[model samples]
Target chain A: MRSEIIITLVGMGIVTYLTRVLFIVGMKGDRLPPFVVRWLSYVPVAVLTAIICPMIAAPEKHLNLTYDNPYLVAGILTTIIAVATKNLVITVIGGMGVILLLKFLVG
Target chain B: MSGPTFDRRQIWKGFAESVPVMVSVFAFGLVYGVLAVQSGLTVLEAFLSCVIVLAGMSQFASLPLFAAGISPLTIIGTTFIINMRHLIMGASIAGKFTERGLFGKAAASYFLIDESFAMATAYAEKKKGGSVRDYMIGSGIAVFAAWNIGTILGALFGNFLGDPKEFGLDFAAAAAFIGLLVPQIRGKGDILVLLIAAALSVGAYLTFEGSWYILITGITASLAGALVTRDEK
Candidate 1:
């Protein structure tokens, strides 16, 4: 297990470093291709949504769309606050508060 | 020295802009630390993962896979795909580092996590009178420090404190991502892309394991956005 851990860490480090430095090393002073730039502009939203949605929809490792699901309830409440306020602290705090409160009342 | 150098004032401003992001990163990191240890990793292993990989979501996504005794190569592949977005992120900001040359860029890019990249790129776009590299470094350093500190604390004391999920600490990552994502939606195309991304993500999740869905759905959804917006211009 220790050996496996070392191997995984080393491999992950190399791969992550390569990605982080890919453009930095190769691009020099040139502008990125316009098409690439347009596509890249959407990457963040795509990736972030991809990360968030499944977790909310399946907090238990499977789909749970029921109204009683605390995560789903808090997730909707959080999404509304997130879009409305655009403040990180409020969204996180407000969302967590809702989740815990719902868990207390519902669970 | 001709252009804006790494002055104290600029560094201070950069640090100030980063405090909020750093707070969220710290929260996420603390949760990851606790969970990693609970997932059968040693404290030292968890700490090393933080210092080495430094990517939050991938780290969290891989913990369960690792504990399941999956192949190391497969885990590495999963991590790489989940982080491939960084290639685009690095490329987007590569122009700002032209003056710094290769070594300086190599140093700065090491700390180019999502928050630092967003903060730095937004600052650069404003054409502000400060060194973009310096601002990035400041924000990056704060995030790195907070992550490492949070990891250490959680790894050592997490088991004693009980499960992080009991208080909805499990929602930290999702909440942070939503907080980050909401600000990026600018137009109908972005909204369309986001919905497509969410749908594809959940669909892919049903068919896939780990974080492959994030990579596959994210890139595909971005392509959908590109196609949708192509006729606009």
Candidate 2:
């Protein structure tokens, strides 16, 4: 690898590792206030929602809420399947199947 | 403090639960590998990023910047910003590792990717007690293996694989996230948090240019949740 590539990768690695490790290392064995714990408890749901909504709403980088958008159609149906079954494997399989079917039909 | 006991059963459970998400991670890694090589990175560099950086999205984000001849510091800074969400994920799971010593916590931190974090969190929510630290490690290893293997294969033969989107591989991550998120919802409060986060996330995603929407929406919605819900004894 080139010197610049090496430096960039190493730098990126260091910072990324820091981000992953900082809080866990810093707060180990330390108790926090109850409200702080409560806030942290909500992090997973909030963060996952934040990540998922945009991707499904705009699979092509622009919002398309119509039925023509296979991602929207599949995302909604997959979510329903997820809620009804609560099985990750089935949800994923059903999701991929629905999207492929939608693409084949819509195309 | 005692080190975390590496429970084989919990680890196996973690690995098994992670299998569903691994499909998407592998797909993304393949896509990343192809893009990295296409962007002028050598196969070694692409593989090295997967092994060391281990953050797929930031790695993907950095490729364009690196190809554009941006300064190394700029690329690395953008990477830091893109991965800032890890801080919240780490803090959220930190409480679970209180019994573990620094060495255990430090070791576990390397495996704190988004998928593993979500899986471990969901697992913890479902099961009243177990070694989440060990579970996280197991799931992390499973994801790490899938990613690296996919990168190697993709870099080697990416041209023939075609677009991952054509097969709807891109939806795998969204589907996995949905599956994990749905089980965590119990009451009206959880539903409220989900709605607020989703609305703000979509709005901020449309409005903003970078990955800051995740951190912005995550913190704001979670804080709103904390304030609105009554404290249980």
Candidate 3:
């Protein structure tokens, strides 16, 4: 493995452990401010949308909004499945199936 | 003061309740492992990531950035933000551990994943006197074992599978993100945040040159959404 990769993994591990351990050990009885909790609740949806939007909209690092973009079509379908089913396993597996079928027919 | 005794019944109950969740976690881990190897991580690196990081979403989010050759610091920073929710989860679970000693609390904290936290919370609500800590540890161990095993097997399979794009695995990350995000959208505020983040992130990807878009959009959109919906309740 590359040295940089190792450093990144270890850094990630330390920060992750800190996030989990801090409140349990140091701030046993304290509660996070309600606003902070609310803000934090929004983090996952925002960050996840940020990540997913580009991958689907610009899979080639440039805009491609047509059916030729398998990621886009498959992503939309995946989102529907996810929202409707609310099951991770089904969404992922179903998404992959859509992509494969698209690639087979279009690509 | 002595720590609470390790209740085998509570542990067993926790482990049993986690079986359904374990299946999904294993599936997620399998995808992560495959994507990790496909994104240029060696098998050892992929396996180590599961063992060390243990946070599947952050680990999955890092793959594309890592594959793009983004700096280590940026990837690590992204990991921190992605896992920040754990702080809230830990705080909520801490109430159950007031009787636990420092060592016991610290040790139990290591096993605190999303599934374990939810399982412990539900167990506490359902049962009157059973040990939540023991339940958490049991569920944690079950999740940990499934995740690591799935990762190893998937990593090996990915190593042999050659190109991920052939199998349409390239879209797995986006698919996984959607699966994670959609379930969390409970109100108009969340939808607003999602739209804003999506627009800003795509714009940033086109305008900027690096992965800073994620961090910038995450912080800006969430804060804006929270403030805008502050009076909704």
Candidate 4:
């Protein structure tokens, strides 16, 4: 198990690094297609939403939209604060504060 | 003019910009470490994963599969898909590094995670004469150090630290990603794409295994963006 885990981690690291440097190495002097650049522009926002939303709506490996789910409540609150403040520090603090408060009260 | 060399100011700028999000990244890293240990990984294994793989989303995504005793090949494939965005990220930033030699580019690329890419790209577009390579390397190193240190603390003391989710630390990554996502919402098309991605991501999570939802949501949402923006173009 230990050796297998090591191999897996090393393999994953190499693959990740290779993918990161792929275009830098191969497309040294080439211009990316307009459509491809446009496509890439959307990747960050798309990937971020994909990663964040499910986390809020289904944190415990299942869809839990109920009020009891602190993550759901905090997530929604954080979204609102994020849009309002546009500050990462405040948003995290606000979200974590609310969830911690809820945890203490609920417990 | 001075010869080409790494700019200390650019590095400082990168380090300063990353400070805002580093806390959350650290917290996120802590969550991963705790979860990795809980999923049967030793402290060393979890720590190495943070330092080596260095891709937060893919690392988190792989944990469940590892716990399930899945084959390493399949797990790697899943991580590969989850991290495919880095390819696009690399492509987007490739133009800015044209002057960097192969060794410099390789070193700069080694640490290009999402937060660093965001900061580095913004700096590249706006800076007067600084090295984008140094800025990204700085940002990446800062995040890299924070993440690995957090992981070590989490792994070594995870048994003593209790459950991260209980204190809402587990949501740190989601919240951090949200902060990053909000500023990028530019138009009605972007909003629609976000909604579609969110819905699809949740659907994928509920229906599928591992982190395939990320890939599915990413592809479908990007396609939606392409279609919606087609009229604007």
Candidate 5:
């Protein structure tokens, strides 16, 4: 019970409810324009990429072209699995393996 | 009589799909609860975190932002950036709801998790006219239940987790993220966008100063990929 924490949670809950409920209550059977819809379709991938990519390879405070990068190894493995089999479980296993390998081998 | 709008069958379906994932996500909630509580969040706050956001990645991302003393404005902005993916998910689900009334379409939008979307789309592809409504409730039940249960467990028993370091629950966010992502890449649009976004987001993190950079790079890259295809098809 911190008052601030409770307040924050309430704020978070209201915002979340609005975001979710707005979609259900507002859109119903309606639609956005084709141009907007087309743009919207790409938003997920774009935002996700912007969010996660480089952090994998260059986690240091600064970027480098050096050889030691755990994310690069993980990325390569993840990509190969994704492309070859399109199997998520395999790719995750691959990433985990890379994570463990990096912990043991690189450090 | 026709089934009620929120029928028991659909609720049960939702419950079933959600419980298994709850097991996995529970570990994560434990991690979150311990950290958030230690950071001075109340149990109610921790519980509400899951109910409100209902997203692992965003909530995890938000934690460091809070700890770092980032402004609410910055936190909101970053979250909006991270979550812009839902806009695309919403758009993809848009046409699927064409047959639904405005209210029905609106309701469908709230339950747009990866599993729900995949299963519902599969159901739609298999059957004409589609079970968009049914699938939404069915899959949504699982996602919703899993999230709530995981959060509550984390709040109640988070201390018993002993050390998150030993169990590697920290990886839960990345692991769960990739797990959900891997299972969902079914088409060219999805693949291309995912690949580029992955690359660019990593790149941005390497070069830029903040987590927001990752979101920026990812959004730009995905938008580029999505533009490669035409809507007419």
Candidate 6:
């Protein structure tokens, strides 16, 4: 267990350093290829979907999910408000409210 | 050129924005704290992991696999691909702040995350000057502090929560991602790319039985998405 922690920690440290160093060395800040810049805008949205996939695919795996997943409900509500209002705080609060309401109703 | 040192003021503004970010990061930190211990890490290690990596999604993604004795190589590779967005983000911001010097860029990159990038980009697009930089500082410091504190608190009392399953922090990640994604989801090209990546990722998961292969398919899909979007330019 100790070896695992040490190894993971060191690996993490290296990854963090390398990630930053590669960009710094490449002087990636200079105007990117228009081809790449156009692509970059999509990266966040694309990567996010990638991250989202594993979670939705295995809802019952690590993080727990029940028949009534308030978090899920609140998330849907949050997405709606975020788009409609284009406000992060409003969306977050709305989601929190949804969750709180669900908790009260369910519990 | 005598420049007034506004360092103190900058620090203050940084602290101010950090407060709310602290709230969100701390909430996630609470989950990480408990989960790290459950994954065979000690309290000290768990708290420090937050301090060091400072990336919530990557940390959480790596945990369960870590517990199952996945190879460090796989962990590192998976996390790097998952976080490849950082390369794009850092690239975009670098164009604006290169004159700030190498050290400043490195320092800035350390705290770079989805929230910070979104905040910075929006601020720039709005043509706000100092507040853009100040907001980043504020959010970063706040997230850092809140994360550390949350880890310690979670480490101490996380077990008492009995099971986070009850609260369903599970949904928080997806919720957070959706909270960000749905706002930005636009155009048929965007929808098509997302669907391709989604389908391929799900297929990979079923066949490979792990999230590892999903990275390859996801990136390939993203490249294809970019190619299809090119003619529009």
Q: Give the per-residue lDDT of model 4 (tens digit) for B128-162.
A: 66778888988998899888988887777666656
Return the candidate ranking by DockQ, descending.
3, 1, 4, 2, 5, 6
* Count of clashes, each model: 0, 0, 0, 0, 27, 1
Number of colliding residue pairs in model 5: 27
- Clash pairs detected, candidate 2: none
True lDDT of residue B16, candidate 3: 87
lDDT of 1 by residue, A4-92 (tens): 79889989988988889888778766666666666767776787788788878987778899996777778888989999988765787
TM-score, candidate 5, is 0.66
lDDT of 3 by residue, A48-90 (tens): 9989999999988998899889899999999899989998778
* Regions more than 4 Å wrong, model 3: B1-9, B231-233
Instruction: Give the poorly placed runs of model 4, Cα more than 4 Å off.
Output: A52-71, A84-97, A100-107, B1-43, B56-75, B98-101, B114-139, B154-159, B164-180, B183-186, B209-211, B230-233
lDDT of 5 at B136: 67
Candidate 1 lDDT, tens digit per residue, B127-225? 965777778878888888788888877778766756657756667556756776898898887898899998899989888865577778777998889
Give Cα distance to truth, residue B185, candidate 5, Å. 3.9
User: Which regions of candidate 2 fall more than 4 Å away from where they truly are?
Assistant: A1-16, A23-29, A59-63, A84-90, B1-50, B53-160, B183-188, B231-233
By summed lDDT, the worst window of 10 consecutive residues in model 2 chain B runs over B158-167
TM-score-wise, the better of 1 and 4 is 1
Against the true structure, whose DockQ is highest? 3
Candidate 5 lDDT, tens digit per residue, B165-195?
3443333334334544554455777777777
Per-model TM-score versus the true fold: 0.75, 0.60, 0.92, 0.71, 0.66, 0.69
Q: Which scores higher on TM-score, 2 or 3? A: 3
Q: Which digits, one per residue and each the tens of the lDDT, describe model 2 over residues B1-233? A: 45555778988988998998899788667666766765677788889999889987678667656665877876777677557668778877887753557777888889999899999998778765888888998999999989998887767764454565775656755676677689878777678889999999999989987666776887789899989886542
Off by over 4 Å in 5: A1-16, A28-30, A78-97, B1-46, B60-69, B82-112, B117-135, B151-176, B187-209
How far out, in Å, is residue B125 in model 6? 6.2
For candidate 1 chain B, the 10 contiguous residues with the lowest summed lDDT are B1-10
In model 1, which runs have C-alpha deviations exceeding 4 angstroms?
Answer: A58-64, A84-96, B1-28, B31-42, B60-75, B98-101, B118-135, B154-157, B169-176, B208-211, B230-233
Clashes in model 6: which pairs? B14-B138
Residues forming the 10-long window of minimal summed lDDT in candidate 5 chain B: B164-173
Name the best candidate (by lDDT).
3
